[model samples]
Target: MPAASAAHAVPPGRTRLITRPFRARRIRRALFCPQILVLGLIASAGAAPMARAQDAAVKEAPARSSVAAEIRAQVGGKLRDFYGPRGFWPVWVEKDAVGPQADALLKLIDSAEADGLKPGNYDPKGLRRAIEDADGSGDPKALARAELALSKSFAKLVADMRAPSRAVKMRYLDPEVEPRDPGPADILRAAAVTSSFEDYVEKAGWMSPFYMQLRKARADYGKTWADLPDVAVPTGLKLKPGAKGPGVGALRERLGLSPGGGYDKALAAKVKAFQGDHGLTPDGIAGPQTVTALNRGPKYYARALALNMERTRLLPGPWVRHVVVDAASARLWYYSGGKLDGTMKVVVGAKESQTPMMAGMIRYATLNPYWNVPPDLVERKIAPKILDGASLQKMNYEALSDWSANPQKLNQSSIDWQAVASGRQELRVRELPGRSNSMGRMKFMFPNDLGIYLHDTPSRDLFGKPARQFSNGCVRLEDAPRLGKWFFGKTLTTDSDTPEQHRPLPQPVPVYLTYLTAASGKDGVAFRPDVYGRD
Candidate 1:
């Protein structure tokens, strides 16, 4: 509603200019609180009725450059697709000046930083100035530019608020589901009648609680750490608790402490907290990795958290029962009733064969599973050895017609190993289940075209490393026995000469393969390395 205290300066049928004095917070509060708008004209101190003035210019809109051409130069062409269908009518301005609704939108743009979005992306300052500059000019060209800019900004904000559209890529198929976006007309019209702009943003509700948490982290970090001088500890430097030296001083200063050479309990606690947040070992020691993580500024955290927030938005959840494999963090979590039921260390895909982000339902369990060696792996490792007359039986492999467990072993002399290596002859290689089998004792199957699944590995020692990206693509569980027990309610066992067995789950469990580099949990905000360079 228009301010009740102000006089009705304009006639009932006319629109008003934006020159009316308004308290800054009041204007912002009005934008957010009221979910609906009354669409009353706002009166300026001295300007004439705005609707009467706007009507003449709007009618002349048809005689000018094509609407697309006119607006596309100011607002992007892709963004113009929404407003263009309405004959490029201005949505934010009243005649020449921006109205209170536009004021609310402009404020939102500035405050979007809370969500790690750059306000300048929507050109709020430029649009506001342009609206003021054109207010008294009575020039159609300038007013049109202002209108186009406002609409473009509004559309982009609405779309992005619903889904991080920029994060949508063919490579990250895990975020395959699209969040719903309201039609532009519906949004813009709602803004005109909304009781409060803040209410509208809350009503839009695009961000999940996870996104809000990252955003909160960004805000908290910005308040205290954004301006701190960066710490420059040399790589490989290690500082244990109570160690006194230059490294300790760097650590102290980095933790916002007044420089003291002595490392104290207080400092150790801070270091441990930082370690926990950054997915480190949290030993209260300043190692090279921990030092590097501490040295990063809020800007880095903001951007990283923002990207991860986008990644989080791509996932479907609040799941009743599901598993999440955080590829970047190399952690697997099983959730039921919105609480963590189980978690385990995981070895994900290496940089070269980066783990794919995807979603699927666990279909069944493979007992005494045969490892169908991928063609690429066969060509890379096995081909040269077998071509030199190495024993295939000693290597624990047999030639198979396809991925199915039952296959007659091909005669080694009859096979042309070189031809197989060069792909001239197609060959399917399988490794029989054994104590040293690559797929361990069992494999958890899921339906996806990527040939990805969860399995145990013989390289249990590799899980000891802090950065465990050792797999080709499939995830390797650190605690397979525990996982199997959770899945089947029994211990996993292997019988010699046993055929591969598939057993369906009592109920399917949803699985999300994600690459989030930052998120929130009971541990507060946490960050992981962007192993895939996704950020």
Candidate 2:
């Protein structure tokens, strides 16, 4: 699916993605944007049945407690939606002081670092004081205020979990997308209706394997960046085999590789592996970028762990054969049978023309594919040149009357290039497959509004860059031949001078254009630059 835009600007010489304004218009803003709704009305969720107690007046038998009334006025709607009113009166309070429900909430709030939050932020002190003051006193006003605070805290915590992510709106670029905003009401409802808080927690747990890994990173390592020693990479430091420097010694201390680990072959291998994990060029050169990677402390690493855990939740679902293109990391990963099979360097969307976030199925690919010029570029960049009697043959240009994945060629000189190039008329300008062609040799195709596909690039040198966001929006594969062979189950070539070859996959692989700037690996959790500024 192409990034469903009202109108998309196609930059020069790239495979164009068209806007699906009509399709995008069908959905409402609420489909991606989530709003908070807080409400509840029951006397005592801990006491008598909610329905039976509903008929009784506040002053009557099984009376409406102060907390219930306050919660109703405030968070009752959302609360009732979450912890269902199973004929019980008050939903939060049990035995006057902060109950078991309140206890669990407090602990979760205090240990919020794994999610990139603070205990003080969620008002842990207020809660602790309330719990401490509850000394067998059945003071309705004090208990009710405490209960109201609990309701507020619950809403805040759920909202925090949903926030900084629910607010990230790239969903317009894709509609068939990840489910976001872990519906607090639904989670609370499961918890409330369950036999115990533990069962409710199990039913409503938000942490995935990805999230757990992040928590483990925080636990196994230190909590903050300050807790870990800095792996400072001094400027102009380089350590190759037979070379020695103080920086090399610093590296050993940083990695905790051993006190005497020097610039040996073994240490060089470690450096290369470290570079790979940090999304740097694994040339084993010990370059500046490698230093940056080494110096990334626990604080940033933990944030990466937590932030990407949220990003992982955005994925719609997992697949048996999955192809994940992580734009933030500028890497493409192929997973077969739910395990990583191969990885390749990639160039994602540029800062201005960002590669989109979409999930789709890779149906087929084309061999020696022609590069169809994006329409916006034709009007802005190519039209004037064509009008000025630019020779199509010299420019490696041809005209196409129609548009599709596979287009039919037309005589370039016969058409009125001026009209089409000037934006007065629509014409298809295509660059035939050659050395100059933008899409190098082949392309992996998927159907989407965003028209984002995995393909090979002529500018292969860009892959060597530490940060590789160089595309208009599509992902460019570094080793297309490898992926192509894997996809088609046969060998295909660019050496032949012929028309494009279309090869279908025996079994379609699910493709995900995800933005995970951090992930887990065998050594430890790895962090990457937040290229799209999603962090």
TM-score for every candidate vs. truth? Answer: 0.56, 0.49
Global lDDT for candidate 2?
0.59
How far out, in Å, is residue 253 in model 1? 8.1
Highest TM-score: which candidate?
Answer: 1
Global lDDT scores for all candidate models: 0.64, 0.59
Clashes of 1: 15
lDDT tens digits, residues 84-181, model 2? 34322344454233455565677677667756677677787886665555424545555555665665676566556545365344442323233434
In candidate 1, how many Å is residue 399 off?
Answer: 1.0
- Please estimate how well model 1 matches the true structure, expressed as its whole-model Cα lDDT: 0.64
Candidate 2's displacement at residue 84, Å, is 30
Clash number by candidate, in order? 15, 32
